[model samples]
Target chain A: MTAPDPRLSINQATIKYAPLAEALHLTAGAGITSIGLWRDSVEAASLPEAARLLAGSGLRFSSLCRGGFFTVPEGPARRVAMDDNRRAIEETAQLAAAGAPGSAAVLVMVAGGIPQGSRDLVGARSMVEDALAELAPEAQAAGVRLALEPLHPMYASDRAVISTLGQALDLAAPFAPAVVGVVVDTFHVWWDPELTKQIARAGQEDRIASYQVCDWQTPLPADVLLARHYPGDGVIDFAAITADVQEAGYRGDIEVEIFNQEIWDTPPGTAIARTIEGFGSAVSPHLLQAGARR
Target chain B: MTAPDPRLSINQATIKYAPLAEALHLTAGAGITSIGLWRDSVEAASLPEAARLLAGSGLRFSSLCRGGFFTVPEGPARRVAMDDNRRAIEETAQLAAAGAPGSAAVLVMVAGGIPQGSRDLVGARSMVEDALAELAPEAQAAGVRLALEPLHPMYASDRAVISTLGQALDLAAPFAPAVVGVVVDTFHVWWDPELTKQIARAGQEDRIASYQVCDWQTPLPADVLLARHYPGDGVIDFAAITADVQEAGYRGDIEVEIFNQEIWDTPPGTAIARTIEGFGSAVSPHLLQAGARR
Candidate 1:
């Protein structure tokens, strides 16, 4: 088999059923050099233990799966959400420190949906800003970058209010790039008309903290959340988007973050093999040096 | 029953099963003064007969349901699509002439999805531009505004390539405002961060040809295409969006267009009643003159 692209990172969600040890082992066994960790599996293994395992695998920790969702109204619930995010920030720093050199101390942030029973989308978005104000310093202190992810507009009302790269950049503007940055997830943003320009802007602003890859095709599964696919499995033009990200000067690990149930049901090793193959064909060539087309 | 708002128009798709005559009768029977016609049902009834029936119902023609889907590449099929759109434009003119005074000559445009088997979204989008450029003059000659509708991003790949009001306005910029304008359907664009500014821009540019309303809720059904809800029944803030349209200098009819399976299954009269009740409570107060809250 062709060696995995050095830039390929297996976002753990692709193997949703894998336990932490198995996920890291399967990813590394497939010749992948990096992995992004989700909170639950990491917490199950405990921060210190997860870090130990990651270090043992000799794989870079590309990023922590998430840390936002603090769109609740100001109250005890909001406070609890903020505290959970603080712990996530700490976990991110610890894991990044334990990984092989070049791991990114980035925590993906999914701005929560409009607050329950509320029609105030603008209000809910402001709460994301408020949460960022409250957490930016905590993240900076922990030496972690809060990578704000702008989910697709389909999820704007029920999953996340942040729905565009331009909007994410606007929210990140007030903070230093190291403390607050944006994620360029192909699955979530491939539909944006402003993607090319916004990505260039993100590069100039130095706010692109994470670069994740996946594909989007429709007849989107009943549970739309699992609608993502392996890179070449859908119609997303990875060449263009990947070239855009590369042109933006993002020379970071590219995480393959699929969320389909069919993918999850696959054996973790087989899934990682598929991911490596898909990435090799769909994304890696775009990352190669001039005239080095795969 | 409270009178339907004078600005309100019943788009026939809300009662998807209704024949043209029944849709017109049900709308006028329920005290709604305006009705938007879908091309299929209009053609089914024969445009002349449908026009005669609409005249008898005493309902003003708000706009035509559609005249787009021209993203096909240059070929006989593409020519067919363009010809079909021309026919739709003619039908819009005839129906408007047959309706009561104050009817609008507008043809809604839905930019077709990416061409079959193609992953080039940008290319597909450029096809939309090419279509507008080709058809704008014809539309102008026909005295009908081709109102571009920006479907939500979820449908960007397979329904409409135009996914934001700003993009619609940009596409409409090359032609006269009267020839190429935009449709602001709340269900599709309510998630945009740039919505408020874009609406203001559309007003200044005089491109707000139509304003449609429907609520958006989560757990979208099996066929997400039919996920829209009545105004007050879901989480969309109609007051804010309706106010934005009003402030944008859009004094034209506001169409209530929904595509919910449940709504379609309801008896046409009952559904129109619910739409009226929802609009009365959710959108009317925002449309009244200063201090004329309903």
Candidate 2:
């Protein structure tokens, strides 16, 4: 039998309960060739050790989990966020250097939510644009692309002001596609009505940075932030969306990033196995269709 | 002392704890000229008696709370929803007849959530369009317009598939403005980046059916559906949104409709008072600004 698609990636956060090195080892052991790493876990294992582990595992880094929260209002706070982001970009460059050729070298950017005590959403978004303009040079210099991720509209208040793929692409329009791009995560964007047009637009603009997949479940856990489910467990049309993204010319890792507690509680190896099983059913056909579309 | 700006209305669902008669009495006593009625309370008191109560109290019906759940796929279920909407239109006509001239006589339509066991959001939205086409003539004959309300995207999966003001306006495009229009509720739309443009579009199209206001709160309650807060209690930019809506030429009632446990737990009188105070602080200035812009 053919091995599980090498391009199928498991974002470490999907099994966040697993320690970074263990998640990486388990992903490689499961024959998956790619994994998206989170900075928190990378920082927790010391970057040098994390680098050593990745080099040994042969797992490609399909984009770093994140590095953008530029919504703070105070000058000092703003500087601190930028400083952290710059460091994140440097780390992303290092991860990319360690990965095999053609692996995703993108650094995902989740624009932070509204500033404290501020009702100015437009103002807050402007801050993100200003922040991105400031960071573009640093990202380009570091050889890391900034992938602006548009979280679901539900998170517009406290998680991200960027709530739609079109808005994200628009924000990225000012920068070079290599310096700035957008992340299309099904969990956050599946409900968007303008998704089809936006995905195509992202393709035409050559700004599709990372394509993440996870299903959206409702009654969204009390801490809705962590409520994402495995694909096929919820109502998303994975086949259509994957096909659309592929049609958009995103020839990159299909990263599964489920954030549910139950999945995290499972044994790491079991979780990865289940993730692969879900991915095979939910995404494979779309990849073939996307090839046909081209 | 200026009598709650005659156009500032109260949707009965905002103070759902109050009985139909008592809520009306309180609204009229408060000097608020309009109140949007809900079917449950109207039915509880009997529609005819409700009509008498409205006529006697000198309060106008800004709009009936709602009537549309066309997302149900079953043949019997679809017929039931259509029949219910027809009755709702009839009720809207009766309420309009009871109110003083110039009062709102629109039926608010919340396109229902996705059907049980179906992940077809596009199909569900199409069902709403078909339902609206069938109901438009009925609404026209009754002299009560159908106001399609685009609920927040968070409600897309379960409460309303129509998740944008633009989509709502698009659905209402085929019908006459007097037969079908769009409702802009702040709680559901404040996060939309396309809001200002959509509000202007709705106005240009003469599709502004009702303008409702409620603030969006976070760490949303376990029952996220009822997590909305009173104006000024959350993160929405009421001034900008209200100003934009007013700028769009919607010379209609600004109905306050919050769904929250804490607000409901408060005494109805206190809740109404708080809502009015919140509205004055959060929304009134925008109305004045809109007038100034004109």
Candidate 3:
């Protein structure tokens, strides 16, 4: 098979069961030069050790899996969520610092769902704005870009309330693009009618922190959270969306972030191998490659 | 229980097993004065007999369940869909003529998803636009309003490419509001950040052809199509959306079009009664009821 796309990053969730060490070794061994990590795995291996492993693997740290979930009403719970985000911000900074050259100090943010037992969707969304205003400075100080990821509308109620790239961009507007950016994930926003316009807007604003690739298919599995598929395996037009992101001027690592149970169950090496093949066939051609060239 | 909400319409899909005679009987028997119907049930009863039964029941026809599904690329298949929609338009005009005063000659349109095995979403969406342009004049000539219904984004790939009120309104813009309009269903659009703005826009354009209400709950069913619930059974803020629709000048029959399997299994009478209770408790208090008062 062709070598992994120079810009391809295997998001840790694609090999969910693989711990930090194995995930790192597998991604790097597969000749993938970059990886995005989940906080749990990093914390499992402990930040310093995870950083040591990442540095030794010679992989660029694309981003931390997540940091934002502070949709709670003002209370101790809210405080706890804020503290966790601060810790995540610190983790992202240290990890990015320890990675090979070309690493990005970015932390993906999934705005939390509506508060429990409450139908106050507007209130819940406002809470995300409040959290961003509170966390933006801290993230900036840590030299990290808080990447607001607008999840698919299917996950709006239970997972992430941010359901459109436009909404994410509006939230990120108050901060610098390098401080608060947006993630364009194919699986989440591929069906959007405003996708082309919004990708251009994100590019013009220079807030395209991460461009994730995956596919969406019908007969979504029992747990919709695991409904993601590798590039080219499902219906997402990666070429179209990648072209949009490329035109928008996002010259960054393109991460394959599938959450399918089948992919997670596959041997890590095999999973990474499939990712490489999928990316080479479905996504790499559309990329501008200036980032890789640099 | 308190009297059924005066403006509430029991959409026939809420009682899927009920035949036309039975559905009309259950709806009118429960003192529910209005209903929206599915073409399958209407066809099953035969149009003349169905009209006779509806006239005998002395109930108003809120709208027809659906008409549009012509997202297929230009072909014989697309021609069949357009012809079918024309028949649906004729049926809407006839049913409205047969119903009690205030019956609306509205045929709801669900723009079909991406054509089978075709990843051209934009092209598929254009098919919906083309279908509308072809049918709008015919519908107007028949005194029928084609209400473009934007299904939840989850169904964008396989059910309807029109997945937002804003997009539906955009598609409906080129036609006169009386000929082509939009359906504002709370379940499909409650998560949209621009819901209030779009509802106002639809109202201002005189294009609010139908106002449908249903709750959205998490842990969607195995068959996500049947994931709808009674208004009070989930996290949807009915008061908020109902008030928005009310303020937008949509003082028409509010339909509760549920698709839950358990609700479908319930006796039609019980289902109607439950819908009455749900609408009264969750939706009625917020409605201005000027239409009912008139």
How close is each model in CA RMSD to the real structure?
1.9, 1.7, 1.6
Candidate closer to the true structure by lDDT (higher is better), 1 or 2: 1
DockQ of each: 0.84, 0.71, 0.77
Model 1: DockQ against the native?
A: 0.84
Clashes of each: 0, 0, 0
**Candidate 1 collision pairs:** none
Report the poorest 10 consecutive residues by lDDT, candidate 3 chain A.
Answer: A285-294
Candidate 2 residue-wise lDDT, B116-141, digit = tens: 77788888888988898888888888
Q: What DockQ score does model 2 reach against the true complex?
A: 0.71
- Docking quality level of the chain pair in candidate 2: medium
Question: Which residue segments of model 3 deviate by more than 4 Å?
Answer: A291-294, B291-294
Query: Could you tell which candidate, 1 or 3, scores higher by lDDT?
Result: 1
Q: Model 2, B226: alpha-carbon shift in Å?
A: 1.6
Tens digit per residue, CA lDDT, model 3, B1-294: 779988999999999999999999889989899999999999998999889999999999999978988998888998899899989999999999999999999999999888889889999999888888899889989999999999999999899999899999999999998999999998899999889999989889999999998988998888899999998999898888888887788888889999999998889888898999999999988877474531
Clashing pairs in 3: none
lDDT of 2 at A212: 91
Question: In candidate 2, residue A143 scores what lDDT?
Answer: 83
lDDT of 1 by residue, A1-294 (tens): 778999999999999899999998888888889999999999999989999999999999999988989999999999999999999999999999999999999999999999889999999999999999999999999999999999999999888999999999999999999999999999999999999999999999999999999998988899999999999888899999988887787888999999989988888888888998999999988896643433
- Pairs of residues at least 3 apart in sequence or in different chains that clash in candidate 2: none
Q: Per-candidate TM vs. native?
A: 0.98, 0.97, 0.98
- Cα lDDT of model 1 by residue, B134-222, tens digit: 88888888888899999999998899999999999999999999999999999999999999999999999999999999999889888
